[model samples]
Target: MTAPAAHAAPRIPAPPSAPADALVRLHLSESPYGPSPHALAAAHRAVDDTGTYPDPARTAPAQAVAELLGVRPDQVAVANGSDELVLLTALCLGDRQRPGVTTADTFPGYRICLENVGRGCREVPVDGIDALADAFDDAGVAYVCHPHNPTGGVLDRAAFDLLVERAAATGTPLVVDEAYLDFAPPGTPQVPDYLGTGAPVLGLRTFSKAHGLAGLRVGYAVGRADLVGRLRAVQGSMPFSVNRAAQAAAVAALADRGHLERVRRGNADARERFRADLAARGRRALPSVTNFLAVPVPDAARAERLLERDHGILVRDAGRFGLHGHLRVSVGKAADLARLLDALDIVAPVTGPGPGPALPTAATAQERP
Candidate 1:
């Protein structure tokens, strides 16, 4: 029998890995707070029912969301998360090769999703909607994440109305990602409130942020009945038959108006204080109505790294959004804010101790101590 030849030297290519020990994360925009106590209790209650498949239609939670927003249950379509609802909605209505789907440079994922579906996206500044009317096709769609990420600014109601009117005029569908709307200033428009205007708008909300249920992954869309049905068909049997527990918690959280108000008030106070602190320290902050503040510094990446490595406190740097001079910090409650502020003070470099011990003008350089 012939013997096998000697094997050649083996080759092992190193796998590409993310940088080691590089901030396990405050980069992801998740709530540092845990879910509500009531939501936890509901999850426990649902554990016994794990033996069975959840209802494909998810009627109960849909009803809960409907009641919360004053819309018919049929008008709502629940999903695994706001992302799911967004992708499904795009699948149902957005045509990447066509003029329908559009988003600003704010979030890349939305644009990526649209591109995946063969739809095109256009980037626009987060100003009045009037500036964006030219981008909508006669029969297309538009998507905007209000209180936009990486730049937290709310387009005024007048601008929202302009968007609705433009969409109505062009027979274009508008998908408004109000995922952070609950954290918006009070009296922000509700799902039904926008729907009542007779414009083709779909409102997306999530339990992930304000309800502190990001891990549970429950969110929904409020839209015209026909539109909701289309998304349902495109989404198939998802809406996770398992999301009931999270829904129950969301309902309870909504009912606890006092708790929600407290959370908002805390965020408001934190945002103002943080901005003021930044100003006192000679930094700029973008105006915002959401639970986060975007601060503009000279070198945001450097600042972010310095804080994480030196102080173990992290905030999101806007390098991904092309705003390399800014960072986004989520507004937390009192203690969290205090911790962040302390970290900021520790990490931010003091520029030359300002004028070096009271320089005496032209005579100062010669007489400096």
Candidate 2:
């Protein structure tokens, strides 16, 4: 099929803002800073003790997470990653015969996992959160990405409460992928805030983002004990999923509060700089609380390809999630962001309504982290 022509992205009223290590990646929302020194050291130490199997119950990290969340250990389930949590939630957390629900232009994993588990997925539009909330009574389960992926938008507290109330009334499960929650500003509404309501809400978090453990793939779910128990039951089928190093590192990462704070400050600095760069060049990005900004662009699918092919930079095309004309760029290291700002100026010009140079084919689907 022929690719779409380059076109001008819709502009926001003029505020803007806008990598070279192995590929200058602005994709997959990976953290700019590496893991904390404490976490890294723990992982190294744990690596040396690898002759023994990791605990099948994932006790240590689950206990650590429970303490951190002020929840019981039974309410937390550690897993290989949020991706695994998504799959497990699909497998056992709701009415198996019904379809799962989520927003359009979201992380595709919910739909993928639901379909894979024989529970089809129903996607509502970006502006339709209320609609999605209302539909929950009919759904077996629903997923919401807090500080949402691809778009980075979030619900206000009132909206979040409605979803929870509806889930409580409907007896349907609500899974909130808070994979990016650690990066959200203080007071951002999240699943944890509503856990006391006894709603069937689950928050899937990861050590991948602010903790900088993407490579280690350790994540956890914290929610109602019943939902978490279902996840743990399903998780048991894949024992030893989180390795020794990942668990030890997660425990250590939680210990080093300073490292996490530094990441928060650094991410804020990088995100604003990128936004300023884009604004200076007369472009706009969606407002975001997460570590990535969805920046408007001409033909995101092609811009994504050209950015990488021509500049050795990789960014996600928001078009992949059924949203078009934008790229979801991570708030990566400063130098890398500068490189992308320079590259994007060339690949996606600020002035025209027509498309950029045509490529032969569209970019492929990017995997969720």
Candidate 3:
């Protein structure tokens, strides 16, 4: 929402590819299963109304989101996607004089958005959450990706509690990007669990992952009424950001709990089978609660190129976002993973933690196009 020069997007590594329909898209953690039929019908119906402007307030989806989370409508703000919320929060949250902070070796969007807004970002290492918590004392805002993107790891209840306490103590805006939260198991500590505690915390949720609405790009935030108000107010700059189809689709998607449950169960089964297949080949992926796995490779950057270039299979090079030596592979359809497994054996082969470096982490961290 500023000058283009200040809002340049991050560069992602892309090799020339076969047509999208022909490629194995295990790169973006998109749902292989499509959206609920009800959602699809709603979106198509919405398309007919495209001649009219979308509801600037995003009413239907916001209320649906609030209901889903058991939060009041005033505490929800639906957006084009959580990415928009990230940029908006980076621009308008907390003490702007102070810089924002997020975990290093995590998502680049937090740093990118903060810097674009002229608010600098401080990054704590992936294993440095305690350090991240302490930094909140002075940070304008803080971000953590629960069931973290590439690693698919979730913070334990104790760690999440400490973060909530720190945010309350310092009054810093703590933003939890829960884009993949739908795939995480039950009892995973999330933003809503701490809302009643009166902490300045927010959770960014999306229909793109488990709900399979990535193409429609609908995401929302739920938190304190005040924080939600600020984000809602900020939407004036892009009032129709959430389009007719996306808003309609998201509401329909949220109502179909059965579809979401099926997706969760399917993904869990696929992820485990994929992990077992890797184990059978003497390769191991880090444990994950989300829908992707961080598979180690001798050289992540090189492996990324070879996978797509040689096999027309796309997997994220974790190094591009600072977590080196791993490929962030989405747990896609069974046939696709089988193909990727076959391809990886040739491209990155099983290189046990050799002399170089122990690949730093068992898990790495996701990104945009």
Candidate 4:
């Protein structure tokens, strides 16, 4: 018999390609207009001095952040990004025996850090503030993603007060991730107000969101001097993580208040318009106070794939944060939002009546940070 005919290997289909210029990245919540001109100039200038190592003490950036926040330099702990600060908080406060406490649908970085250190999270429902209070034992750290992640629902003032009071009573370390706080209304209460309350509170702020410096990877934590000192101790052994150029950019970014305001106003307008467009198409979006919104869809994962492959529009599937049937769309420029709306019109056509009022219900809740 002739040698067995050579078997043909099955071929896998290649994914559909999107046009290079048509790609609209609305997934990471980056600033559509990019960094301030002053920040860009400062970063470019600092590039000339890269031959030398950055200040191991991170003095200039720390002082800049402190000045902006009306706190002492000693109270600030600068890091690679807010994500690193989250990990540092977990490393300092998490206990392998006791699970960390956080909202079930909040940012996943804190929980991931805890798990990496042999700890787990005890997640409470987004609306279950009372349950969260009960879970606040002194054995582990508690993370509060203010204005919450995927869903963008902030704890009311009363709920926040309760959380702080309970944490203070239990002597639990509270890590408040305020990465998206800059997008909230002006004069909103920030973490610095609770500094001297005798509770170990670490308030995290980042240059990524409103500051438009995500690529620079700069963020800081503010707290009581003692708490900040603990984080410094943990970060001491590492080489200068925040680079010199990034430090310069962050300092300059903080000084450009006008740029920040413009970004905030533009985002607010675009976010409302995006929500209205979705509503007109029979989709519902949760109320948002940040640079993103979560809209419920028939199948979130499928929707994400379809948007990218067919329309060159990128969005996040909320399933990664334990949310089902929702997509997280970051607020971009007006043109970008228009593109998203046009794409949605095709991929997600309206069928029946539009969804009810934009309130977040159990079936379609998401949080943002």
Candidate 5:
């Protein structure tokens, strides 16, 4: 026993190669268009003062956001990213011992975050509105991704209203993720509308997607002042409070409505065109309001591999989410979609001989490369 001395365990080795830096990063949904020119300039200005710490109060950015969203500065809590906001909100509302967070099967990373914190996520299969209504009854914290991911289907307004009402009545906090809401078709309710409904709702929006500031990692949550205060307390005094550069850029980006419109229209048109092209190739793409499409294939992995290894194009394999036979492709520039279409044509060849399967075409593929 004396001979058995304590020792450090073996360490795991790193990878052999220089590391695969650009290995088909299509796994994450990201904005293809870069950040606004104004935002970029603001970020540059921020570099000038890197020696000094960012303002702890983060009042200017908060004020700009409040003005933009018709809310008070105290009602907003900015964080490193919307992902951080999601985690903080979850921690504030649900305890590890409790049921914790609830999300649909197809969400991005809510369950992963909750589970990482030794918490549980009550998953509800995302079938339709009825399923969501049935699954969200007084849950610990219900996470709803508006204009849902992967599937890209939006909850009907009536159903959304009912869900919010139910959450309010039950005193359950509903976290509505509007990360892609900026690209939603007109008439969709803004984040404030849900908060104004007297519901315990935390509306999370991010500059990562639409504003093309993913690199800056800026996102904010709006809710009742009390809830926002709770989130801020959970956030503590982080220097990441929307740095001066990101704040300046976010303000300019918000002001530059023209750029937003261009991106929105571009995404919408590309989405329809891509779906149509997939249909022509005997595949189907799920309709989406966000800047991405989910193309269904008989073999998602094969399609993804062919795109990455063969054509040098990247796409997200759905098999990781148990959604085999599908791949999520983000919309980029017109030329980018053209390249994607050409790559898909070469990779996932349509089966059967004559004229291929007859499917309802959503749009013409004349723009397809």
Candidate 6:
């Protein structure tokens, strides 16, 4: 018999290219400053150890994060990113027979994760905490993306306290995603304080934002030791989920408080300036405590495309997150914001009828004392 015909190797498509130098990346909420010098040095050093397997326990990063948050290493579970932690939470805690509860307008990843695992998700309005409580009563998991994604609204301490109490009373798992909490003012309530309340709460954080390490993809979840243990068990299966370079960088980034503070201050200034510029141009920007501002536009999709194609500036169309006719623009460096503002001035004049009733502002919820 003739030799079998040579098999053709499947062609793998090339991954998408990174943003070009001229492309203003206000879409992803990435830090404009990039990683700290210490983190960069640590990452470079880690590159020399590429031949060895990374620590599966993620011990160094875990201990660093635990110390920073006043939690024990056993209460910390590191992952490839907080997104992975979110997925792990769903896989480990969600039940097909029950549902996951969350705000209708959220980061979208949580709903996607829950639904991907064959569980239903119930979404209530962001301000509908009572409805959320009722939904959580019957849910296998509850998620609240504090400093909520597109709108950037944060739930007050009282609201979070109530949620924690409900979680305790109902014996449900609560996931508080603080992906942008580092940008909020100091003294903002965080997840570590609730750990001793006998409630199953998982506080998810990422090094991507204030630490300027989005490219590294490192994050962690901290909570009760038993609950964290469960997450760690799931994380164990994905050995080296967080590579050595990322873990080292995250640890170094945590120690660089000056860098983080600079990011917070710079972002706060840029956010306020951007919002004010928009207001001066007869547009409304939803008050934000996070690094991005959500501004209502005539058409989100059209505005996003116009900015990219015409101005070489990229922005997220909040319609993807159920906030129609709004654009989520990241706070960039002063020069970058100047470029964006100029581009906005050019694009804003031509945009047609604006968005409907303004979404609720975070002013009521996130007002700094």
Alpha carbon lDDT of each predicted model: 0.66, 0.83, 0.84, 0.80, 0.69, 0.82
Cα lDDT tens digits, model 3, 199-311, are 99999988888989988888999999999999999999899999998998888888888889999999989999998898788777767888898887878888889989999
Name the top TM-score candidate: 3
Give the alpha carbon lDDT tens digit for every residue of 66-100 in model 1. 88778898789888878887777667763434654
The segments of candidate 3 whose C-alpha lies over 4 angstroms from its true place after superposition are: 1-21, 351-369
Q: If both were scored by lDDT, which would come out higher, candidate 3 or candidate 5? A: 3
Over 4 Å off, model 6: 1-21, 94-96, 350-357, 361-369
Better of 2 and 4 by lDDT: 2
Please say which candidate is ahead in lDDT: 1 or 4. Answer: 4
Q: What is the TM-score of each candidate against the true structure?
A: 0.81, 0.89, 0.91, 0.89, 0.84, 0.90
Query: Candidate 3, which ten residues in sequence have the lowest lDDT sum?
Result: 1-10
Provide the lDDT at 91 for model 5. Answer: 77
Q: What is the lDDT of residue 60 in candidate 4?
A: 83
Error of 2 at 181 (Å): 0.8
Per-residue lDDT over 1-369 for candidate 6, one digit per residue giving the tens place of the 0 to 100 score: 112222244423557887566688899899998887888777767866779999999999999888888889999999988999989988886344787888887789999999998886888875556778777778999998887888887777877888899888887888999999999877677788899887988899999988888888999999988879988998878988899989988888888888888888888887888877777666777878899988877778988998999888899999998887788999887777778777776776534443334847332245342
lDDT of 5 by residue, 1-369 (tens): 011122234323545864444443455667776776666666666656777777666676777789888988998987777988888876777333555444443565778777766666777654444555555553577777776666565666676787788677767777888888888888775558877677777888888888888888888888878778888887774555657777666666776677788878877777787777767766767667787777766778888888888766778886665455678888766666677778877877666642332231211111121
RMSD of each: 14.2, 12.0, 8.2, 12.0, 11.4, 9.1
User: In model 1, which range of ten residues has the least summed lDDT?
Assistant: 359-368
> What order do candidates take by lDDT, descending?
3, 2, 6, 4, 5, 1
Better of 1 and 2 by TM-score: 2
Error of 3 at 82 (Å): 0.8
lDDT of 5 at 162: 72
Worst 10 residues of 6 by lDDT: 1-10
